[model samples]
Target: MLELDEKFFSRFGAEYSPNEIIFCEYEPGYEFYFIQKGRVRIVKIINDMEKTIDVLGPGDVFGEMAILEEQPRSATAIAMDSVRVLKFHRDNFDALLQGNPQLAYKLLLIFSKRIYDAKRRLMILLLEEPNVKVMDVLIMLAEQNQQFDFESEITLNTTVRQVASWAGMAESEAQKELTHLARLDKIELYEDRIVVKNIRDFQRIVASRRKNLYSS
Candidate 1:
């Protein structure tokens, strides 16, 4: 990310209230935004249901993919709280990039990272079995969600249904798999959270399961 000065944000920033829609998927995107304050949720519609792809915070830039790819918006951005963003339009987008070498470089890195993250998450969705997908989703979140104080154990604020949504499987299927994992002492499940006993152990389990899935 570029070290954007306060002046750059203050000059072009707009405020958004909590739960406000920054942009919607499939809409004609003519501009992009840089988050100056608060958080934003990146959501995609899957099977007529909204699935949150990611939650982005300050210093992050979004909606640029639409402008860069010259396609309709692929996901919707919603304000998670009181938010401030520096909105940039396409008209002078090139000139802005040409003038700011650092910003251009940062955007390129963001593109690369987003693509890799998308492919990584797709791994769970591509799996054949719900049990395998559930385990894969847990592994994915353990790696991706930085809030976890990683060590011997790490807990996450999530539900089985949320994991199912990410895995693109039924909530019942996710619940059944999660119970099985819990019984195996792989994870500690609660009404609102899950505690992964060890990330490496979880990875090993998922990898073995994935291999068997492919072999069979």
Candidate 2:
């Protein structure tokens, strides 16, 4: 979580529930938020279809880009579950950052990482095969939401539609590829989740896909 002065939160703390819209794409952004709990999905409407670009959990921040750039929002922020957030008006945010150098540095690091991840996803989308694209997205999600357990499996707390959206493919196509991978014993798919049996093997598959992309 961001280390803000108590005065900041006393004025800005707010709560939201699942399916709530925090902000809409292209709308003017007045405030930015830091998640205190739960998750939020960053989505964009492409060709009239909503595509989820990223999921954020506790300690994550959103809406700052628009504030910093002084432009309309680039994407829509929707609550994924019960969420608590600290909202800061543009002036308050600037003041907070000025007072807390460490927080500002942390925000810079987060933005840098997001940019790098976006570039990587773009590269993955350029791959030719839908199967490869699906596998790449699965691996990426697994890495982002890694689960440490005695069983050595990584579980994705996401749905097929979101995965398909990330892969730039239809749900049916993503489901088919996922089922094929499951049949090959590469992963275990449940009604609401997916489990990668071995993280090492998952990485190997992703690496092979990259190799094939280059080799071809």
Give the top-scoring candidate (lDDT).
1
lDDT of 1: 0.83
Cand. 2 Cα-lDDT? 0.82
RMSD of 2: 3.7
Query: How much lDDT does each candidate structure score?
Result: 0.83, 0.82
Please give, for residues 14-52, the per-residue lDDT of candidate 1 as tens digits.
Answer: 889999999999899988888878999999888787888
Cα displacement (angstroms), candidate 1, residue 14, comes to 2.5
Candidate 1 TM-score to native = 0.80
In angstroms, how far off is 161's CA in candidate 1?
A: 3.7
TM-score of each: 0.80, 0.74
How badly does each model clash, as a count of residue pairs?
Answer: 0, 0
Candidate 1, RMSD to the unseen true structure = 3.2
State the weakest 10-residue window (summed lDDT) of model 1.
Answer: 1-10
RMSD of each: 3.2, 3.7
